[model samples]
Target: MPEVRIKKRFSALAGAVLAAALVIAPLTAAGASAAAPVLGTVGTIEAATSDGNHESYWQARYASYNATCYKHSLTESTVHGAVTDGGKTVTLAPFQSSWPGNGWAALIVNSGTSNNVIVKPVAGIAYASPVNNGGQQATVSHWIVCKGTLPTPPSVVTPSLTFTPASCLAAGAIVFGQNVVWSSVKNADGTTTWTASPKAGTVFPANVTTSWTVPDLTKLSIDLEGCRPTQPSADESETVKTTFVCAPPLATITTTTTKTPYDVWDTTLHKWVAGTATSSDVVTTRPLTADEQATCEPEEPELPTTTVDTKPWVDGSWKCGDTTVLQTREVITTVTPTEGEPTVTKTSEQQTRKLTQSEIGTCPLVPGKILSACVGDVPYLSYSVDLPEGFVASSEKPVTITFVNGHGGEDYVVTGQPLSGKLLWPGASDAEPKMWPGWDLVDGQYVETSGNYAWTRLKDVVVKFRVNPEYETTVTYPEATAECANPALTSVTPDDPTDPTDPTGDPTDPSDPAPAPSVTPTPASASTDNTLAITGGTIQLGALGLGALAVLAGVGMTIVSVRRSRKA
Candidate 1:
């Protein structure tokens, strides 16, 4: 029995060895006969959907394995292959997988014959590193199988971009962070580049906030791509724009007018001609023009008035008759005899008798004609005589006497007027005998009397006068002056009163008295005689008290004279 058992065991071992050979020999032969070991006849490998929502399946086939096949299972296998779906090549890798034949084979039964067969077909086969066996070790054909057709990739909807600051930013303005939001981003290639508009080669995060130094205030754009990076596109968000300004520099201005005289006399005109004096001669209490008034500035004051007198013959007169007879004669004559006397004279014989006319001639004769004495060193002619009754001297008559004093000193007298208020001699009308001459007297004084008078009647008249030594009078005037508050900023110039354009009008006009001119002192010629005198009846005097006068009645009247000195 041991021998018979040994034989059967040997036969069984041999049969088992033969079956192992049958399984191993062809694989070895197939490996030797074929060019390379290949997982062939790959049925299909596909992703469930293009939306990344469904799973992927890989179906593959291996060459026939005759002997009973062994199975090996695989977990987490990565399958990679280029699949054409709708003419577009798409690559995929398996993330997970399962296998019922332990990743090796599947069982099958022949329908016609009652034969059970073990077949190794690569249906539902799981793969790991499908190309080169994950490291150049394995070779396999790959195909994708899907329940439905693969969908297209979603359109690349570019993200919207925006800048913080608007246009025209000032210098040193802070640049804030930017906002980048996505509308849609579906890239089959799994790689893309995001870029800024206007070719801002700045890098940014995929889907997050980003920041960059603004090189300058300018327009910008943004771009997105799955294949490669590109410049900003027109489809990017709205553009940006800004400005800057500096403070204006401070400005300064200055204005000025020339300074000129206030009052002056024109010597060539000979009259009291008005001319511009120095600015010092102007007296400005208030502004004259609106422009000046706005400044509220004061000007220089005016000069004071200096007065002079030129009357002559003080308290002296020309006598035409003797002291006794001159009083008795009704009207005196130019020629009189001093040798004859009106009273009877006693004869040498001592007889108390009326002396004969011849004897009277021998007696002492009363003085008849006498010449009036001259007063000052200035030469002046004088005449006096008794007047006739019926043809009386008109009180208004003006005597024309040449100024022998050589300086225009000839003066006339008006009768029947006060010395301080005499009507001017040679009055305006000849018919009015009482009217005196107006302004015909020189130096505003009469030759005879230092008193004012009116021409009341025609009668005897006595006068004496002299002329002024100088051509023009120099007067001292008072004035007020002002200073500018800020000389560096502005300066004030005194106004001229003598200017014809002076809107203040004439100072002498009672209706509009101009402000006084400022005082500018200057040296002048000295006066020969400081005292003035008059010998006529009445003399009208000025504020300076230099005047003469004359008085006349039906009959001739004696002349009166007076002398006065000017105030120092």
Candidate 2:
């Protein structure tokens, strides 16, 4: 896109030069009496107007790309520039090349514009052809057709460059934020004058700086012409050169899990946080220690118990065979019971146990400590502490659990249940009066007497629990007493037989004959009235409907009688 614009600007400049040259041609022909022996020199004279301004001490710089021959060579210009088409052939024109002290040597830039006029030198002039550089590809060309001098550089604008951030690891791009852009100015000399791309807030002769949000790139290239350190005469055009500082996305940490310094859950984040302190903070769980494992208790043990089987005995019953005498059938059920002693083996576990002479101890409820009888003595043991089936343990408080060292070493008992409440100390008795292993333990039931106590944890945590108080059920117990009067009967009528022979009427003897029922007739009951009467809240349908109809008829007859009396 930039190249196309450059060409158009030069084309306009060239056309104007040709027009002015043609105009001068007629004059040259009229004055001279001979055909010109040399090719026509393109030139432009100052117009009738003046700006009263001058360009100060102009300078030049050398720049190059691959020359026309593909070899490197320095050209006396910033970018390839030309007035007319540089690719076309043109006749030579005379121009003075004052390089440093190398005074006035007839030279021309070939291929493209080798130099541009900062201050319109004398009347603007252009070569008909590119300057010859010995090598075919190393030629610089400049064709100028000017009016009075190249239009004074549009305006000197200091090229200001900056990046959005200045650093990033993403693609960087230069975007216009602020600054004046240079424009191509067409001159009557048949040449185009263009200034550097504009920067916001730029003033003539003053350098301006602006900001741009660079894209995800590392480098930005601005291509334009007429910008050089040596040239301070005109507002040289520029494509812009912005240096961006980019920070790309952090790299992933490629280190494997085992080799990684951090316990990073995601390896990709390693690069991002590699140098940070958090790099060592990876997702992980603490391992269980040997002592910690000792605190854990295994699943509840399977208690040994026996299964019993028994056949029920059904007695004989008498039934009428649909006629005369009743017959009896007896059913006898055989009973068989399985008997055997269960082989029970207790597995060793890490648990805190009450200290005992035996290697193992059992937790059960009793009056006091297990006993060796004293003169047929009653054994007194401590009441067992247990959780009810529906009990959801809130917490466990320490209650001097004895840690026993078995054949293995140390057995530290630990239940998975969490602890709650406060620590239980020594010399504290249980909630009830119970015998300890001995009178000595009675005072220090919870205290560790042996120095070895510190080696193992006494984790007998007592759980304080309760059921919903409102749900308590109270049962009333009837007092037992001897009854000599009569037993209240159920499903029996008053005429039911008591007994025939026993004067005491005791029905205990099954062999005794049953007494016949006796009922006395009541004369009042003999007065037969088969009617079902409607009383209470009940309405006898058949009787009720008929009674209602009768009442209605009687009311109608009375109403008619009254009406007749009134008429008479």
Candidate 3:
């Protein structure tokens, strides 16, 4: 039993050693595959394995697909393999190989113990390993032949555009446009580049319609054979094109005028006053001609007067020579010619005549007394009367007449005179005097009259004279002066028959015969004496003496009378 156990243990040990060998072989091969290989083209040899194997051998057989494989110009090559000792580990390599022309290449690996091997191509057919084992030998095939080159990039066409007005033909009207002409372009890669058209400096015709089109283009660049061809090779067989629309142009113009509305004024009324006419109030349809404007002139207004005091004098007063007279005269004068008359003439035969003195006296004089009569009643008389200085005469030609009382009255009559035409008074002419009532007599004693005058009577006058004529005039006489005359005295006696001391029987005694028992001085007789004296004596003296006696009698009557007897 111990021998049996020992034998079994030995068998187990052998199996263990074999299994260890199997695992270690694949691990070692995987480690070796992890290292990168040196790449080379088919038919070219390069060291690929750390054991010094050539890459061309692998690529020429399995990498190249048994037939010779040439390098592809623009693609990569790859290869795949597994371990030789029945392991699951695989190895792979990528190769970047280039050739001058297009061709085919292949890679190959040896099948160990008749196991199958696989190869895969990478970027280029450089070299490859067996698919199942690392210890297997592999080879590649390379065949060289001329393949077609890649196509060149298509050319880009530059488009064109323009604008024109479709509606009005004016300068600033809205406008539309059409595609314009442009150049085409070419690219290096096989790709198409499109470009939009530009519109700078391009003008379309006025009022025209058109369209745009893009034509099919040819391949613009040359191939290795220097042959130009149309686009869309055997791989792509379609054509490209485009279309566009066009636009129109517009029109232009301007405007003007000749006149304005603010230049006219109206003058319809005869005068220029407020509310008559104003510049803005007048409207003019057209401009006035120079002649029409020049002919316009304003009219004049009529003169006005008041009837109350139209003449030169305030009343009928005239400024005659210093004295005025209530005289009348027929004046001879030429009149102002009327409208349309040629000349006025004076009448040859006594046009007017002076009033006779008798005619003047016919008008009753004012009832007041005469205060002054500077100009006497006479014909053809002119004199400056002596009137109180600074006294305004009722009339410049004043005829002063102070009445008995202080009342003043006047009756003046003036007529146009013959020769000198009534001797034009200071403020009067040959014109008739305009008379007003009410005299404006200020402080003064007299008035004077001037002008030709004549007097008919001089009654109860003070003094009168005529100047310039040196004519004698008469005045009424005044009363004469008187002297005092004395008269005889008469006596009164009392008679009695039985007297004691009587001889001839004269009853009244001369003295003290009988103190006639208190006879009252008969008031009647005293009053008679006063009357006689008042009537007979000088008026001034009798009045004074009587006045004194009256005063003494009144005082004495107030006192008591005392009588005394004399002892004889």
Candidate 4:
């Protein structure tokens, strides 16, 4: 039925006038005891609105399809009116067994803002046989008319804020730690923008932006060089200064012992270490003292000495003695007035802090598709992993799965109907072959003789898998009907070619020699004979034999007109 609404200025007057003609009063049975008064009774139900904000009407046109029923004989089972205002609804009393007429029947609703006029189908309509003498099944229809906007309700909210540490992968050097407050607002386009403000003694900028399609957390960083003091180096005035002086009364030789400091190699550190030393002594002549020079003798002869051999018949030689000289000469001394350049050792420092943001929105769950199927009275479930829609998976890790058989999420098998034979998927692969159930695998498929049989018969299989800790999904394979086609035979024993039942004569019988085998190169081009015969080990040339003959001829075999038969 079509419904039409027209706007009217005189809503209050129009509602009252329409109620007299359209509204039907509820009828009570004669002598019916009053338990509770029925709905839609005139004078018992009050009008929803006296000063109407809007006004409209709806009519339901129905007809009986049975031949014996008149067009105006059908009536509505019940009728009720509901008024909605300020998000709250109130239903007026209903009219029962009403609206049986030739023309349109009106059900008035004293409505404000929005109204729903409901009409229910009667239990039965009088009709002739073949329709079962009952009314056809019908559904209740609702007609609504809404105008003036309703008042919106106030939303209740509790303010909350949180701070979380950043992950090791997302953390950076010199990460600033700050006590900040964050607030988020949803935009009309379904995107969310997050703003942050630092508290006392805190420094940094934080931000987050997200939407239904994408989520992004901003990484905040501030350059410390802009506000911090500059690093300093050692002063140049601390460098060491050295000088040398040479002035003495006479030349002198001094003997002294000295230790040389050196560094040793450390194998573990792969570097040199200092503080070890080696000592030695040296001798030289000194100048004569003033008291010893007063008693000194003049002109003493100097002699040299040599090694002498004391053995028999050996000669000894004498030489001049050694001499020493002292003279007025210069002396040298080295001095350092200051220390050398200072070594400045600098150590690196890394400061880091964590960052976290509130969750913005939720992602709609996408259902996974089941890829399992049955082949030849056997079920082979898909062990392959795939990411569902609205999700992205990382390739760094493998997907883990659990297979469940039967119903009610429990494992079950029929006592007498245990499974037989293996479920084979010829070229299919399992991610974890070792973990596969009791089945002997050949290539990638299951072999019939052996199998990891957990269930005798798989009516349904449930697959639960997880791509990672964050994403877990479940999919199901419903009952399947396998196409169990009959297997074809590979080879068959030949029938007696000379038997009377055989139509085609024998080619191996010499009494009636058969024509020579066809020399057609292409086996597909040859006409086939249904008869079968054998001469020695070879059979008569048939569809497949024609190709063999061509191969033999290509190998330089002579083609003969008559074929050989078995010797008697």
Q: Residues 258-343, candidate 2, lDDT per residue (tens digit)? A: 22222222333211111222122123223334543333334413222211222122223211111122222222222222244544
| Native-referenced Cα lDDT, model 4 | 0.27
**Of models 1 and 3, which has the larger TM-score?**
3
lDDT of each: 0.23, 0.24, 0.24, 0.27
Better-scoring candidate (lDDT), 3 or 4: 4
The segments of candidate 3 whose C-alpha lies over 4 angstroms from its true place after superposition are 1-102, 111-126, 131-293, 300-568
Q: What is the TM-score of each candidate against the true structure?
A: 0.13, 0.14, 0.14, 0.15
Q: Compare candidates 1 and 4 on lDDT and give the better one.
A: 4
Clashes of 3: 97
- Residues 501-522 of candidate 3 have per-residue lDDT tens digits of 2122111111112222121111
TM-score of 3: 0.14
lDDT of 1 by residue, 273-388 (tens): 22332221221222124542333223422211111111211222212221211111111112112244323222121112222222222212111111111111110112222221
The C-alpha RMSD in Å for every predicted model, in order, reads 48.5, 45.3, 61.9, 33.4
Residue 493 Cα positional deviation in candidate 3, in Å, after optimal superposition? 99
Candidate 4: tens digits of C-alpha lDDT, residues 364-481 = 1121222333222222333222333323444544454444444444432222210111223222222223212233445544434323433422322333344422112222221221
Local error of candidate 1 at 473, Å? 70
**How many steric clashes does model 4 contain?**
21
lDDT of 1: 0.23
